[model samples]
Target: MYRQLHNLLLAAVLEGQLPAGTKLPASRLLARELGIARNTVIEVYENLRAQGCVEGRHGSGTYIADLSVDHIIEVPRPVEAMPARPTISHIAPALSQRGQSLIAGAGFSRRQWGAFMPGVPDVREFPARVWTRLQNRHWRKAAPERLSYAPEGGLPALRQALAEYLRSARSVRCEPEQIIITTGIHQSIDLTTRLLADPGDSVWLENPCYWGLRSTLQSLGMVLQPLPVDAEGLDWLAAGTRPAPRFVIATPSHQYPLGMVMSLARRQALLEYCRLNGSWIIEDDYDSEFRYGTRPIASLQGLDTNELVIYIGSFSKTLFPGLRLGYLVAPPQLAGAFSKGSAELYREGQLQQQAVLADFITDGHLTAHIRRMRGLYSRRRQCLLEAVQAEFGEQFEVIGNNAGLHLVVRLPDRVDDVAVAEAALRHGVLVRPLSRYYHQSVAGQRGLLLGYACVTEAEITPAFAVLAGVLRKFVKATSA
Candidate 1:
């Protein structure tokens, strides 16, 4: 009752219905009229006073406080009395052409947890109990510094743990001092772009890369040069013919969507090319923890003898996306600048969470969780493969399934993948059209990117059945 009255009066004051300096009705009178206790009215007034919406006088009633006229006038109007909103020209100039393009080309999905939503991990499998325990432990300790803003680079313990783990697991050559913890791969990319490259500087991106990365780079005014990717990974021969880019962003461990590992020779050539051309290589080694077959591929950062690589990784894939914990390993020469830039631009702070994550890693929970998820993901991958083969026979070809959580199924040349994907969504299945990943539309080899990591064995076949129905209809229609 108090809450309702408080909200009503607050809204009235804010909307100018009860204008500033207007006296509210006496508490006793209001209570009697509304059939509530007088104390309730008093409480409402007290709350409004606390919020600065009203001011109280010792012997007088409460009065509305003076607020900005703009806010006060922001109330609903009758349809007949409503005024047309000011046009862009009357207010301010329209967004720049680059801003307009970025908004138009935005590709983030509204749904990220349903069937075949690529690049998402099975967050349900995350060790919630263990994480909670670690979090609680930190809270109980309640160190003032831990609760405050974190240092620019990261929590020292977390950085040290990450440095040791990366050295052994991903073969990354970096000290803890070289690591700068970021929110995720996106922030890492943003920081690197701002610090290393200027506006209008050219950056090489894989022809069909992660849409989010493309959007991020484009939004920052970086001139993106799209280089084609074959089975061996990014085509350097074609890249050689193009003007030298200031930065090159690649996923060497597992390329996004396509899931191709950059070949060893190609990795060396890329490093040498960057060395000679004075280009910085931003290696996004996201999700290198989950590999189905063979050993995990060593990171491209380890092969850099010239300190040309800026390695970025995230816990989003391995742990959970909501964690928002990632790290950037800059070269020794650039570490201090990267750290300072992170602080200056982002001012990122989540020290307590960092402490919990540090403990989670040091206590070996991270390694154990990864090991468990790898086995489960392997089974789920097999289920998806079987379902696809059962539904389509040998007509559809699966590519880049040897590692990573997702794979691409190449569709027939005539089939429209976008149409099939839209139809699949209607039938309660989600898959990304391969063509959407490309910067420019290319003919031949249209496909669907299907992620099985978050889907269970039972959900796999049923989901694929829906997708298969959609694909068959599209294929038949297009062929006819």
Candidate 2:
């Protein structure tokens, strides 16, 4: 009853039926009028007063508070009673050409976690308790300095921790001072593109590269040269005839989607080519941790004698994507500039998180987590492979399965991978079409990128069965 009375008065006040500064009826009078107890009227008035809807003087009755006229006057009417809205006259502002292109080409899914979602790690396997404990430790005595905006290159301790880890784990050569922390590879790449290259300058990218990176470069107005990826990864010979690029972005440790590790000869040639041509190499060493049955490959940055490579890595895969922690190993000569640019351009801060991460790395939690995930992912990868083999026999070819979270299944030329992917999604499976990754239509392949990392071993067979059914229908249709 009190709720009903409170709502009634609130509506009246908001609708301006009881205008601001107008005195409400006395409690006894309002109760008698509504045929309710005086106590209920008192409660309603008290609630209104608490909500700033009304005010009471020491000896006077309650009156409506002075709310803005605009708020009170703009109450929405029922659909049938509302008048027609005015037609828009002037043209609304639109996105820029580059912005439009980005929107058109955006490939990231809103749903990142599900069966066969590529490039996503099993975040469920992450050590949440340990991470929470570390976070708590930092916050327990979070000094004013710790809570404030991070120092120029990020939290000093985090940078040092990253430098040490990279040196030992990935064979990336760099001192602590040369490390610049970033939110993730996107920011790291953005910093490289802005600081090193100019608009209209040529930038060489892997033919079927990560879409997000390609979009990032395009948005910055760089002329992207999509070099083909053979078994060796990024055919440098094919790119010899083209004009020298200002920056060459390569995944030397493990090429994305295709998952091929850049050959040693190719890596060396790439480094030497960049050194001779005065070009910079942005070696994105993303997902180099989970190799199966082979010794882990070292980074291209470590082989640099001429300081031409800018190594980028992220903990997003190893720890979790939400952490958004990554680092760039810059040449000692350019560290200060990178640091200054990072501060001036992005002003990224998350000092307390960085501090916690520093402790997480130094205390051996990060390494231990990676080691455990490697074994788990390896089993899941095998499960997926067996499921695929059981369903398809030898109808398809699997590429780049020795390393990384995903493997590519090359299909016959006549097959439409995009159509198969769409059908699969309708039937509750997620797989990226290989053709969509290519910048040019001429160089596209008909294949599917199946990610087994996030999918559990138990869920793998069923998911693949659904995907296989979709594939079989497509194959039969194409053959007919």
Candidate 3:
């Protein structure tokens, strides 16, 4: 009878029904669901586990192993051979001082016409009913202290769920103890900055980066070293002569605003550089889930061997921003410090929200929702790309449309991006200027960073029409 279940699972794998690295149902739960003995399920699991069909970690649950022939594939070609990175003898401190006011307000409050607001999920597409159901079920089973102060490391169940999700989706290797949940990316960055960086440490950031990162770091009074980002992504060598940077904040999967994937070679170089310098790397994996091409690129944290990388992620991009749940995956060394800081200062996350998230992850709602949204966003990305080609012709170049909510559109050299963005805003189309993402020193990039995930297909045509008018006005104004 135990062999019966093992054969059933093996057949699912052979037929591609289970897919590689899929999490299997917990033994006890599966037994209950199938009306079988617990030991029978256990025997089945042990057999498959011995055969290498599945793996179970202490505290973490079991997962089916990938038996692909090319499991140990070689790294892809180097984007460009990085020059020997400069060694740091002196402690290069981060230059940007946390600004006079430490607390910065970050929430979506702006409303405008033809809004191509990036980094926002389509709230209407959210599975609210399923979420509500999980919330209801979890509420009934809540602990007596559910409303009281919780652990600073975050709810155990939510961390477990996140650990499992990251393992399958991003290939991130970590346990629940490594996970620290925050209110959003802003909070995660703040917490990490507080943990790893000093008041005046030098930090490396990608040019045309996420404004939120710049605002957050600068507000913390950390010196930001901006590196130019190209089609391949951040120029790893551009950190400039430094008191070696204390941290390199990067969105390697799909760079913020630029939308370019940081190549594998650069990621390795970054890891190596951080290792040698004793500097930490913050892998801000903002929007890698919605790739239109092959499987999403594995995360940078997946490749870190030096324990120098800290991973940050948010569900606000995948789910709704209202959820305000983001997390940090810290190195073992920072784990205790972070826990202490969170406990003494921030405390833990909300019990009800974390409980609902746990249910959402364990019961397979998140996996199902991601599958559904991946298809939806893939279509929307295609539609937007098509619209760009149809309306603007091949003359207007688009960059970074492969995997993210937004991409940078470089207009003709004569056109002024700032003027165009201003004109577009007047027409009720709110596209952001690419220069806004860059620091004041390098703010002349003539492009618009347009985001499409939150915008509907029905809204696309008019949005583009307004954008085209704005572009035309820019051309006219430049010629005049």
Candidate 4:
């Protein structure tokens, strides 16, 4: 009752109902008027006075403090009476050109989880109990080192574990010293780009690359050369006219959005080309695991005897996206600098989480989880393929279905994939328009990227049916 009364009086005073210098009634009078005890009234008055909401004089009764005497609170205005604030154009721009560009070209979708959302894994099957146990084990220790800023190049134990894993699993040739832990693929790329390529330095990018990859490079002011990607992989320097780039980013294991493994010939040629021209290769190795009816593709970095390749891999696709853990295998020469730069730039921390992840990897959980998910994702991918085939038949061509979490369903040149994707979103299905991945304007290879890894086998057919219906509408319009 006292608190309620005190709050009411404070609100009234602040709201300007009980204006400054307005004398409040005596405690006895106020108590009688409000049907409360005089002691309660006196206590409420004392509280208000203590809080500077009210003041008292010896002879005169308590009064509302002159709030306007210092800082004044503006009273609430009626909707129509309030003045309109300036929009982005009217006010000084809060962000720089690069910041604005980054926001405008953001590839992240608001809907992270749903049917056919590309490049996401089903986190439901992640071994939470096992993870929690490892996490808690370290928390129990409460070591200052575990809680402090991560050392240069992140947690050493994680890096050593990753180096062992990469060497055995992906055939990446690197010592533990060469491995630099990162939050994910984005940070790895950013760190590499800043270290290796300067602003305006030519960097070869595979056409129809990951949107995030392209946007990041562009924001950094690197000159992007969009090379055509065929069934074999990125067709670099076809004309032999353009100058060699400082960096070349390729998804050799599985091409992003268009899941084609880069052929051995192409990988060799790219390595030789970069070696001779003093260029670096960025092997994304995107989703090399989960290959349906195929052997694991080796990393391009393993083939590089000259050590020109900077291999980056993300646990986001393999384990779960929320983990935000990834690694970069830098060349022996640049490894130390990369580590120093990562620490300097990001002030890297999260040692405890990294420790937990290291434990997850070393304890055989990482391999075990991948083995389980491989079969599951393979089935889901097949389901999505069958669903698309059942509905669209020969009207759409499904390419890039061999490896990776997602595949591209190609449409006729006349169809607008963006429009189809938008219509699908309206029906509560999420998909990425293939055209959105291309950095350069191209003539008609319109397609949609459908991810099945996150969705169950049952969900794939139904969700794809919704998307197929949307595609059919667009196809009909295109034909007309």
Candidate 5:
């Protein structure tokens, strides 16, 4: 009876009748449900114990092993029919699935597999209590102006705070009037893209650049001119004067997708070129605060005496995502135009959130948070690097290690990054494939861009163990 009972239990688990973490009925209850003798159930329990099928904790009943959870078994039931698959032809342009290929953060999930999605801050460490207290205080002392339509330039206090903070931290040369608060840097991108470049106007984009930005330009019908990036950053060789683009977008402090810092010579050349060509340079200073090496790179806006650069920064990377607060420091001449555009179309940013963030920066909370997260992310990067080397050995090479939350893994030409990404997802690990960033598919350079900022050191070992298995399977399949 014990042998028969053990077989039945195993069969139920494998058939998806018993889901992972679902507590088993007590011995008495199980005996009654299956019409078995109490002794039979007890003997079966002992047999399962020996096989490690289930574990019982004090005060907690026996639970199904996580590894034992099988695929969901379809059972016939009278219910509404599921919707059919969406057609590409019917999708609206504004809401189309075109740019969804760009890997942003892993979409929200129920499983706690511990995603290493890029541009994500560890929300567990956010100073929520302090923020809430500040919010409550601001609300209680609110002026009528607080709820009313704000000045298009944004809350004056916040602008002043950001002005001082940028000067000290980013070496930015700007006045309070030059700043305009937007939702985030992405918003700033859209706004600047619309403001600077007309439809069909060419814009220089970093090759293997941030897909999100490229998609935004495409949505606006802006023509993208790919500029190849190497160790020194964007190559200006083929970026000749003909078909001259109206705008040039770059992540100067740390290039996106691949974290290459622009050299001083290149930076000066960029500024000079943009100045002479009358091109508007959009400098996205994303993730500049988390530099592991020397002091953070001085922003291109810091050196912009000719006012060719529009500097953008966001709190989404520094603080939690919910903040949704960011600012753009435009050249003095364009201030009136941007401010008016903000007034007519997108009047008034989030007043309360900006006010709180302004105080946070003013009171030094923002600085402290950056300082703490820098250390935390640095440790996570180190652990991830060691784990990757330990797992893959000479089979892999990592790039973009100096400045961002993530690094790109360059695999052998035989491996396809998209295939590797799919296998990893099946094993409950999430990662971005580097091929996703390429605008036009080019041969060679296929691999994963793994981010470790949001994951814990304890989670790395087990996560990588699963990742290693997936890679091994991928290589095996390709070779076979």
Candidate 6:
């Protein structure tokens, strides 16, 4: 009440509605009239008087201050009163072009956690108590060095822990010295792109790839050549004769959105291609470790004898998205440069959290957690698949490897997947239109990417019921 009155009276004074020397009503009288407590009115007057917007005589009621009060109280201006364009708009900025494109693009959904939200793990299943204990232990012994900026990319202990985990789990041939901790895939991409390539350099990306990867490459002004993926996944030889790209970004462990594993033959061909062309391969091993039937495929980096692959891994899928802790395995020669470059570029530090993560991993909590989540997510995935099958019956074809957080349900060519996604959103079920991931339109591949990882098994069927209603509305002839 006091704040409301203060703002109202202050604005009245600043706009000159209440002229100088205009005596205000008594606190008791104004309070009664406004149906507020007398204290509320008194606090407003005291605050205004302190700011010199009002003055109170010993015996007289408060009055709006003299016109000189204008010198102190700034008048609020309407948003439209400002200039038509920002000052930076006066210059030709390449960043502005990218910024505008990003604004126009499909980004991480506004509602981050919910049914069928892609790329987010079930954070509730994380061993929070264990992490909290580790975090508390770090704070109890609070080392100043640990709290300071991570001068060598990240905490050494965390890097070492990650190195061991990746080596055994993903078959990544990396030493502790080769690991440079990063904020996540985006930062890893940014750091590598900055270090390795100049503007206007060519970057080959998988069509219908992770949207973040596409956005990052586009922002860097790299000429993106999107190669369509098939069952074998992003085959470089299929691209035929063309100028060798400076970088090739591949998600060989499990192709994103579509979820196809790159064949060993294709993986070998890609590595050989990059090695021959002196290009770099950014192998985004985002979430292949959660395979249902068999062990996750070995990383593409494990085969890179020529130091061509930059293996990027993230805790976002395995742990929780909020952790934002990821690591890049740089080639041995560039490891030191990446560490130094990271410090100068980002000045990133959350060393205490990194220390906690290190303790968690080394204590075997991370491994236990991953093992538990694999089972939980696998069950949840089955629940969603069953619901999708029950609702759509074989009318909608669900593609992608039987792995990862999400599944792509292919729509009929004539139906609009975007409309289905939008309508599902209106009914409070989140989905990503598969077409959004493609650089070029493929009407036949129109589908919705449904994430099943974060959603509870019980909620999956109910959510899909709602989504199925939306889909049937958009996908005519399947309306029943």
Q: What is the lDDT of candidate 3?
A: 0.80
The candidate scoring highest on TM-score is: 1
lDDT tens digits by residue: candidate 2, 419-465: 99999999989999999999965559889999899999999999999
Give residue 176's lDDT in candidate 1 (0 to 100).
98
Kindly list the per-residue Cα lDDT of model 4 for residues 91-172, writing each as its tens digit: 5456667778778778878999888888989999999999999999999997898788999998889999999999999999
What are the models' TM-scores?
0.87, 0.82, 0.76, 0.82, 0.77, 0.82
For residues 142-180, write the lDDT of model 1, one tens digit per residue.
889876777879899999999999999899999999999
Segments in model 1 whose C-alpha atoms lie over 4 Å from true places: 1-10, 13-99, 441-445
Q: In model 6, how large is the Cα lDDT of residue 467?
A: 91
lDDT of 3 by residue, 1-480 (tens): 777888999899878898877988888899999999999988888888898788887787888888775674565756999655455652233222333233332322266323587767778899999988888887888787778887878888899999999988998978888898888788889988987788788898898777788878887768888889886788968655566689988898888877778888888888998888888999998778888868888999999988888899999878888888888898887787876776666776488898898888889988788778888877777777888888778877888788867767887667767777777877788788776567778755778878787888888877887788778767777788
Q: Per model, how many backbone clashes are there?
A: 0, 0, 17, 0, 0, 0
List clashing residue pairs in candidate 5: none
lDDT of 6 by residue, 1-480 (tens): 877888889889878899999999999999999999999899989999888778998897788888673566787767777655546665444347788776577466789989999888999888888888888999999889887888687998988998999999999999999999999988999999999998899988888788888888878888888888888888666568988999999899899879999999988888888888899999999998899989989999999899988999899998998889899999999999999999899998999999999999899998898888889988998888899889978887887738898888888767778888888899999999888888854433788999999999889999999998877777665543
Candidate 5 residue-wise lDDT, 416-453, digit = tens: 88888777888788887787777674453687878888
lDDT of 3 at 417: 76
lDDT of each: 0.89, 0.90, 0.80, 0.87, 0.81, 0.87
The Cα error of candidate 6 at residue 249, in Å, is 0.2
What is the Cα root-mean-square deviation between model 3 and the actual structure?
A: 24.2
